[model samples]
Target chain A: MQLQYDIEGGNFTKAGFASSEIKKVLKQLNVDAATIKRIVVSSYEAEVNIVAHAYKGAVTVVIDHEKIVMQYQDEGPGIPDIEQAMVAGYSTASPEVREMGFGAGMGLPNIHKNADDLLIESEVNKGTLVTITIYLKQEGGQ
Target chain B: MQITELAKLTEAQVRCGNGLMHTEILYAAASDLMSDVLTIHHDGMVLLTGLANMQTIRTAEMSDIHCVVLLRNKKATPEMVELAAEHNIILLESPFTMFKACGVLFNAGVQSVY
Candidate 1:
């Protein structure tokens, strides 16, 4: 099953809707709890990034019996330094963003930790694409 | 401790998921910082924070937090309430300051995640 969500930038209130729906879908599908958690974490991190950093974006979720994949694409300022942004404590979010309980520099790192496979591609002054995959326990071959 | 007890102790308003208030919370962590909450790894704890936002609910859902209590008289937005409800998380609002709210919960047997 695949699901897509359009995220409006600067709309903090609507940020996590995609993740929540994904979680529900995963639960109804009866996936492993651990696998569900990984997907949820990754989806959430991506969703927040879309709301915080992007001008606007969409989140795509693909759930298979063996693994789950998530893709986040955004048209934004584009990260100038992927290496710096990957650091655990680096964040470009302003104080206003931090005030809402995010932008703590953990989004990307958390996404990386929770997903079995992570990929990020960005073009300066253009946009970004982040893809994450979490393999199911039954699919240990992953 | 149960979420019901924590709500009563903190004098928090149960905004949603009242039925789930019976859920047991084994630990508690109070922080407005998402990074701080992320560091704590309690599977079924109650999160107490003054920050009321969609990300707060998202953090709790990802971390397996059983419920959230917004302290310091902060009101949760409608979107936040809807998000918490969808996650099956109990959302509560308390007029007590963060410090006092944490103290009350601690006094009533809530322990930090660490």
Candidate 2:
């Protein structure tokens, strides 16, 4: 199955809407509980990132029998140094965003922790694209 | 701890999900940072936070948290209450600060989501 959602920048109210919907889909598909939790956390963090930093963004999800792939593409001020941004305490969020209980620099790290594989590509002054994959079934189905 | 027990410990008001007061919580974490909350791995945890916003409820929903205790007498917006109700997440308001709320729960044998 495939699904796509548009993310509006600065819309904190709707930041996790897409993730919540996809979470329901995953549940309906009978994805394992642990894997579903990981996917939800990773996607929610990615969704929030777009809301915190991007001008606009889109999330594309493709779920197969074996794995779920989520791609987040956003148009905004791209990360100048992906490596630096991956640090646990690195963030560029404005004061207002921080006041809302985000921008602690744990977003990417949380995604990294939950995703089996992650790829991030960005062009300064342009935008960013983040792709995350999580296996629907663990090895040995444990 | 049961949601009602938690409410009693913190002297909290059930802003929503009154019917869910019997729900049991295994662990708890206190944080104003949604990012930090997302990193928590515990299931069936209650979130104690001072930040009252839609994102707070959103974070709890995404994290599978069934209850949120708003500390410092913070009032949740109508939108947040509606979202909590929709998600079936119980919302509690407490006059205690975040630290005090967490401490009260911890003293009552609620494990920390560390």
Candidate 3:
């Protein structure tokens, strides 16, 4: 199954809705509870990043018998240095986002921890695209 | 501890999830940072924090956190209340500060998620 959602920037209220919807779809697919949790966490953090930093964004999620993939693309100030952004304590969030109890800079790290495979692409003046992949099979158990 | 017990121990008002009071909570952690809360996949956990916003509820929903105890009398926005109810996650407002709230719950036999 493939699902897509639009995310509005500067709108914290609507931020996690996409991931929540994805969670429901995953649940219906009978994905295990543990894998569902990882997808939710990984997708949610990526979704919030767009809401916090982008002008707008969209998420594409693909699920099948073997793995689930969530791809988030945003139109906003893209990351200049993905490495710096990956650092745990690094943050460039606005004061407003900080006040809401986010922007501690652990978002990407959390996603990294939860996802079996992650990829990011960005352009400084354009936007960013984040892809997260997690396998459904329990054999290799992450 | 039961969800009601966290409210009782911290002198909190159940702003939502009245039906959830019977749910058992086995672990907890306090933090105002939603990212921190999202770091772990929690089960049977009650999150204690001063942060009350739409993202807090969203964070709990994503992390599988069962309850959120807002410390220092922070107010949960209407959007938060609505979302919490929809997700079946409990929203709580405790009169005690974060330190006191965690301490009180700890003394009452609630295990920390550390």
Candidate 4:
């Protein structure tokens, strides 16, 4: 199954709607609870990032028997330093965003922790694309 | 603790999932940052924070969090209320500040730190 959603920039209120819907679909598919949770977390963080920082973006969710994939593409101020952005405590969000209790700098790190495989590509003046995958099979278990 | 007790303790109004007040919660986490909430390991937890928005409800849904306690007299959108209702998650509003609310709950045997 594949689902796509346009994330509205500067809309803090609607940040996670896409991921919320995808979570519902995953639940209906009877995916393992843990896997569903991980997907929701990673996808939501990515979605929030786009809405908070990007000029605009779209998120794609793809689910298969073996894995779930979420791709986030945004036409926004690209990350000037991917390595710096990936750090757990680094954030470029303004004070306004911090007032809302976000911009704690955990978005990318949390996404990486939840997804089984993660990749990101960006251009400083253009945009960013993030692809994250999570496998159905749990670690160290049959 | 029972959700009903939590509601009474915080002087909260239930906007949805009244039936779920019977649900028990073992731990609580208070944060407006969705990323922080996602980092902590919580199963059957209650989230107490001043942040009331659509994403807040969505975050609770994703984490399997059973209850949301909005502190400092914060308000939630109609859409947020509707979504929480649909998901069967308990929603409560409290006049207490975030610190006071969490402190009250903790004093009443609501375990924190998870």
Best by DockQ: 3
lDDT (10s digit) by residue, model 2, range B1-114: 789999999999999999999998999988888888988878889999999999999999888899999999999989999999998999999999887887778888999766
Instruction: Evaluate model 1: give its lDDT.
Output: 0.83
Model 2's TM-score against the true structure: 0.96
Top of the candidates by TM-score: 2
Cα displacement (Å) at residue A39, model 2: 0.5
Clashing residue pairs in candidate 1, if any?
none
Q: Write the per-residue lDDT of candidate 3 for residues B1-114, one digit (tens) a residue.
A: 898878888999998999989999989889988888888665889999988788889989988888998889888888889999999999999889988987888888888777
Cα misplacement distance, residue B77 of candidate 1 (Å) = 3.3
lDDT of 3 at A85: 92
What is the Cα-based TM-score of model 1?
0.90
Model 1 stretches astray by more than 4 angstroms = A138-142, B38-40
Q: Write down the lDDT that model 2 would get.
A: 0.92
Comparing 1 and 4 by TM-score, which wins?
4
> Backbone clashes per model, in order?
0, 0, 0, 0
**Alpha carbon lDDT of each predicted model:** 0.83, 0.92, 0.89, 0.86
TM-score of each: 0.90, 0.96, 0.95, 0.93
* Candidate 2 lDDT by residue in tens digits, A1-142: 8999999999998889999999999888877777888999999999999999999999999999889999999999999999999999999999988998899999998899999999999999899999999989643464
- Measured over the true interface residues after superposition, the C-alpha RMSD of each candidate is 1.8, 0.7, 0.7, 1.6
A79 Cα displacement, candidate 1 (Å):
1.6
Candidate 2's C-alpha runs over 4 A off are A138-142
For candidate 4, give the docking quality class from DockQ.
medium
lDDT of 4 at A59: 90
Sort the candidates on TM-score, descending order: 2, 3, 4, 1
TM-score of chain A of each: 0.93, 0.96, 0.95, 0.94
User: What are the clashing pairs of model 2?
Assistant: none
For this target, which candidate reaches the highest lDDT against the unseen true structure? 2
